[model samples]
Target chain A: MSQILRREAIYALTGLVTVLMLLEYFFWPTAQPWAETIRTWAIIVFNISLGLGAIRLLMQQSMNVQKRRENWQYSAMLLSLFVVMLLTGFAGYFATGLQTSNGIYNWLFINIYTPLGATLYPITGFYIFSAAYRAFRARNVDAALMLIAGCFVMLKNAPVGEAIWIGFATIGNWFQFTGQIPGMRTFSIVGALGLIAYGFRALMGKERGFYAGGE
Target chain B: MWDVIGLWIGWLLMLMIYSYPLYKENPAFRTAEHMFIGVTLAISIITNFSNVMRMCVTPLMQGNILMIVPLVLGLMIFSMLIPEYQWVSRYPIGLLVGTGFGLGIRGTIKPNLQDAIIDTITAPTSGGAMAWFNFLYVAVGLICSIMYFMLTFEHKGPLQGPTRIGRLFIMVGLGGYFGNTVLFRFTMLTGRAQFFLQVLKLIPM
Candidate 1:
């Protein structure tokens, strides 16, 4: 009974919703409202999943702090900050909607969160350069081609490359559109096919690990 | 006063984040990582909480019987906390998966597949000879790349050459991608640098 309710019933639900959604789009346009309602409910459920994640994190962090695990101090720090921000955000949300432009939540988000994000993102510039240094080594034909192409593109990006010669920009632009477009397009085509296949599998309830959390 | 304090804290935190590459794994870096995650999750939690309240909870409170379904489903997610009731969480997951997959499959049909096929076929169009050449090049590249992804066939005789050409296209594509990414990273660095300079009064705001 337990297995039937959890696995078979869940599969049925999944198949039903998927069929309804596809039908709404392809065959029965009148089912659009029902489809939209399901979509909205899915989104709401997804949002609620975030809370589930928080609860999991809270449990893990509390356990870590309790057991004095490695980097437990960091876990403690995370919990404190999480609680602080959680309270402030919830408190400010009723006062100001979405916490975008103005509010205590936005203030914290902008000043503290924004700076951390900004700095961390740009720091990748350094790492990429380091990566380029290693990866650009032309040990073979493929590597050499990529290196040559990469150099031209990098040169085109820099002001001095176009200043010295317009050919750099031309070649760079050529590589970007001609080289990238076909490969990317093919990838997307293959990817879309794969997505449909996955969707089909889910509809059939053959793919079990996704909904059951690897059970 | 609060604004000024916030600015200073932000700048200091920015400096701490920047310290990661310079100093390696350290307390400051870990602190920033923890703080960033904590605040981010908090934001997500708050936004979702607000959404649930506004969309479902409030409606249900006001006698909207339909809202009860979602509200109950949302609460059911809390079953994940108990090992015995963990399977109960599958209900919401199933709904989410169904809608997501259904919409995804629906979206791909005309937009991704049909349009892409159209572009492939109509690529060699009535333009200058150079335009024709470019289109031909992309068309061939597209075919070759797709051929490379064919799993059933062994790349032994005739298939090997096209697959090789496909790999070359992919390499060139990666190179171009790398260049674009580098340009982006440089742009990001420049913005951060400008921000730093402005904060220090070395440049005009």
Candidate 2:
């Protein structure tokens, strides 16, 4: 009985929400406000869901520390920092009656968070160069053509490349303008169609892999 | 005063964390990794709490009783914590998925499909030699790339030629993407290097 109810609720909710959204798009006169409300509700629910992740993190880290697991000291450090950051953020908001943009919270974000986040992408630079050296070998016709194109584009971007030969910039521009844009557009259109088909399946509840008990 | 010091400290910490994988993994790297994850999660939680309070809680408290429906649905997600009630969480997940599909499908159909087709068909065809070449190139690229994706028909006889040409065009397209990615990474490296050099007084701003 419970299983049947659960399945029914899932199908009904999905169908109702999807139909409401389609109505809003196709027949905007009636369903506008309701569709807007549903969107707002989704956002609210998404915000609430963020706590689920924090809760999971807390539980796992606490367990690690309690059991004296390998690298438990790191887990303890994580928990300590987590609590400190959370407290500082909440205290800043409550004390100032403003968002986290002011006080100690902002300071922590600018100094610690922003710097740490920024380093992530730049670090990828080293990996890209390492990979290019290994992969960009001109062993065949196709690979040679691609390597030549990549080298031209890379040189055209760098100051030293232009200083070495002005023609590199001209050829690079020609390749990008004449070749890349149309190909990219074709790929984008195809990708978008795939997304639409996937979305349709999800709306119809045919894509049930996201559900708890789903295959 | 303190902000400048903090910025420098942050930069140093970032460099230290990033340098770890280059060398062997050690305790210092592990400690930094843990701190980074914990701090990031804490910030995320605080931001979400603020958004919920401002958007949902405040409005509901101010007499928007209809907001209760979504609030309850949001709360239903917590049912996943209890083994017996986990299936109930599917309701909200279903609603989210449906809403996302509806939003995405409507938005994608017009710009990605309709506009793209119109743009390709009506692209300027009459001009100088270079202009004509570009027009033909784009047209051929579009048609051949589209044909390459046609899975219904097997490539044989006359169709084999176009399919092979289409594959080459696709390869060229992929090559362009690879080149662009390399340029982006190089640019990022240059920016970070410039900052570090400035800090060390090796170069002027």
Candidate 3:
């Protein structure tokens, strides 16, 4: 009985929101005011919900510390840093009306957080090189073609390739414009159709994965 | 002076974090990883709170009663923490999903499907031989690629040819994408390397 009520609530809410949005799209003058209100509400709700992630993180890390688990010291460090950052942020916001630009917050962010974020993408460079060495082997006709095309495109992109042969750019551009765009467009269209179908299924309550435990 | 010192420290810490994975994962890497997650979450929470204050709280304080509806709806999300009333959380999820779908469908249909079809159909056929050839190539490629995704028909006999061509086009497209991605990653590495070199005064500007 409870499950049925939950499902019904989900359906009702979904249907209501979707219809409202559709009305906003089609009949702008009529639904504009209500739609704007709803949109603002959605944004507020979404932003508030973002803290749930932080809460979950705190819960897990605190558990690790409490249980004295292996690498619990790291968890301790994590929690301490989290508290310091959070406190500094709130304090800055209250004091200066800007949390991010506060001296301590700015220093920590620029020194620690920014560097950590920047390093993550570049680290993938080494991994991709390793993977390419294994994956780019020309074992068959299709593989050989792909390897040749990939090599051309890669060379065209690199400065050394331009120094070696200027024609690499021309060939690469031709491949991208003539070969890639059409294929990509078809994929995009297909994907969009899939999205629409999935949306409809969700609207009809045929897709219940959004419900916890898939109820 | 202090900012310069902080920048240098940042560069060194970044290098250490990145280099650890090349050898073997160690405690330093794990600590840094945890620190990153913690800092990120802290920043996210603060940012979200600030947004709520500006968008919802401020408006309500200014005598807007409508804000209460969303405040209540948003608060309902925390019900998930209580197992007995967890289902209440589904209301917000449903609304969000519905809004997302409605917006996405309305936005995607014209741009992804209609515009693409229109562009393909209106492709110029009355240029030089090369231009005409390019147009034909795009048209055929688009058709074949679209056909490849038609799961209703088995790729046998006459259907096999187009499907094969479609697969080849897809491979080429994916290869191009992969190459671009590799180049982008290399460029990022170069930027980091440049920063490190400059910080150490090893490279002249």
RMSD of each: 2.1, 2.4, 1.9
In terms of DockQ, which candidate is stronger, 2 or 3? 3
Worst 10 residues of 1 chain A by lDDT: A94-103
In terms of TM-score, how similar is model 1 to the real structure?
0.93
Candidate 3 residue lDDT tens string, B1-205 = 8788888877777767775757778776787788888888889989888989899989999999999888888888888778888888888777678888888888899999999988877767577887777788888888888888988899998889998888877777777888888989988988888878878889863
* Superposed model 1: Cα runs more than 4 Å off: A94-106, B123-126
- The 10 consecutive residues of candidate 2 chain A with the worst lDDT sum are A96-105
Between prediction 1 and prediction 3, which has the larger DockQ?
3
Candidate 1, which CAPRI tier? medium
Docking class of 2: medium
Model 2 chain B lowest lDDT segment of ten? B166-175
Pull out the clashing pairs in model 2: none
Sort the candidates on lDDT, descending order.
1, 3, 2
- lDDT leader: 1
Instruction: Show how many residue pairs clash in every candidate, following the order shown.
Output: 0, 0, 0
Docking class of predicted structure 3: medium
Worst 10 residues of 3 chain B by lDDT: B12-21
Which lDDT tens digits does candidate 2 get at residues A52-100? 7788888999999999999899999999888888898888777765547
Could you tell me how far off, in angstroms, the CA of residue B20 lies in candidate 3 after the best superposition? Answer: 2.2
